[model samples]
Target: MNLSRPLLAAAAALLTLSLAACGSSKATAPGGATAEVTVRIPDPGNSGVLALGKKDGSLDRALAAVHAKVAWTGSAGPFAPAAQELNAGQLDFALGSITSAVTALATKPSFKLFAATDPDPVGEGILVKDGSPITSIQDLVGKKVAVNQGGTGEYLLLQALAKNGIAADQVQRVYLRPDQSAPVFSSGQVDAWATWSSYAVAALADSGAHFLATGPALGSDNYSVWAVRTVFADQHPDITKALYQYLHDGDVRAKADPAAFLNVFTDAGPLAVNGRSKQISVDFGRQNGVLSPIDDTVAARFDKVAAFYAAQKITKSQVDVRPDLLDITKLPGGSR
Candidate 1:
């Protein structure tokens, strides 16, 4: 664990910069306590509450209750790289799926799940052309199916196969990121594309593609997850409480008027879809981003995801997600 002088100096400089970015504000808390009220959260420039909160200033306005402000950082998309950033103390908070979180855990990431949203299968599933012969899970046998490696796409695909008594190896798996898989799927290079969220919405909307097997139909336990740097959560419990409150309230508003909260619920990618696809994404957004504490039910779902990753040999070993979950109920905004 020894580092050269240059490396040590660089690390020290980075830490100093991070601290300066999150430097204490002059605001006083309820008990006349001077709170260090700056949270360094990611801005993936994509959809979701974080982006909406940032754009609308609701995230900052909400954090103001705790005398906190947000220091928006770089993108934390794709989860795995975000975990590395969290471990390196370069980021404070990020959003990810249960599948991403489980895989990130096996790498001994320095992040913890603090809040989560309910499972919404609206736009999660494998998409095939409208007239394709792949009508069911059974049709995937020996066919090339594109999926993001170690992500929701792969996890849902695997779960669907397992649920239908189909062997994982029976289907030809083509691992590709969303951007890369889009063209491949469009050109008929792949029989079906396993995806979730915006990508799924876009595919179905743009090409008249239909769900060959939906996430819920195939029994998906996917959940939207919020993760924070372990050190940040440990040091600023109040800040976490404020954040959870904001998310909860945001979800409430989003659900109440999904059309208005469309920007908050999803990014522009899916919103760009016209007609039924746009409506589908909006409907999915209604109850999708509801944030709640990582309670027993959430933990059980995450644990199941971990077990699946281990069984699929995606991880070296099974990771226990319970210990990494912060009991938000103990925080100030948790009860609501």
Candidate 2:
């Protein structure tokens, strides 16, 4: 579902204030140097990256180092709105799926990717009703499938269907918000739901949906990243570096003790899955001081995503994912 105009306008206004906050003297660098930066976090899921940032104080720590302010905002749709805010100079940075980041860069070349969060983007997966007759991906033919259109959820489902020789035209596609899809799945309106971690896991727990396919199975990189406006980066390079360093450190700490990360999830409210944190993977690594990119297998998964989107005619033009969009080397400790 598309976000209402009022919601979009409010987000835009909040973004403007956030940008203005960054421009104030509070965001200046050490020794009284002038620098302002604000990071806008889009709501993903209960245990997603944004939740992790809140739990571990990653944003606070990162902004503290740069003396910048963090304005966390809830998003209703995909990265399009957030990307628009960034392009309008209303935001300094955003955290979202790799596909979202790619879309942002494809349309607006002024942004640059700084870090990868999950190490493997292809790790995302899809779920179907448990104890149902739909055991294999091929069974999805002619079935009603729910997904968040133009987002990672949609991309993952498309990739899974293509891999199983199931054509998109053969199935009934239902596009809904992540929250809206959850209830519909619970009510048994949809045959299956394609989603990402935490939300997908939670939906399965609530609706008895079993894992049908994961990002890796469908050739996805299963990763997310941080993207920032180039102008913001150029004006506040030190803050950008410090933000990456702080987030990398938080990831390291979270991996060392996954349970500690759960506190953030608990504060946010009940997770999608009850007591399923133990079954989920929360490992994060840092190279040098910045978040690391996905390994070869993971990168291959992203390649498949680009191909699937192209095949579906999601975009009018070919997506050239190179140094311009997925630049992993530019991060402070990215080379490692």
Top candidate on TM-score is 1
Per-candidate count of clashing residue pairs (backbone under 3 Å):
1, 14
Deviating ranges (above 4 Å) for candidate 2: 1-61, 75-78, 118-123, 265-290, 293-304, 326-336
Off by over 4 Å in 1: 1-36, 44-47, 263-276, 287-289, 332-336
TM-score of 2: 0.74
Report the C-alpha displacement of residue 10, candidate 2, in angstroms: 45
Native-to-model Cα distance after best TM-score fit, residue 278 in candidate 2, in Å: 6.6
Candidate 2 lDDT score at position 225: 65
Error of 2 at 137 (Å): 0.8
Per-residue accuracy of model 2 over 1-336 as CA lDDT, tens digit each:
899999999999999988766533244468877554566555544553346776667667656666666776665345667778778777667766767655555574667666775524423577788787888888888898888777777777777877778778898879987778888887879888888754664564456776787666777654676777777766555666766676677667655665555545554455433354335433321121235654555455456556656778776565665554434345333110
Predicted model with the maximum lDDT: 1
Task: Estimate TM-scores for all models.
Answer: 0.83, 0.74
lDDT string, candidate 1, 1-336, tens digits: 899999999999999977754532344568988655678877736455566788787776777766678888886567767777888998888887888888888777788898888666577888899999988899899999999888888998898899989999999899998778888999999999999876777777777798887778977878888888887776666678778778788788777766664454444464344577658777877747578888897789888889889998888889988888888778544211
Residue range with the least summed lDDT across 10 consecutive positions in model 1: 20-29
Candidate 2 local Cα displacement, residue 303, angstroms? 4.9
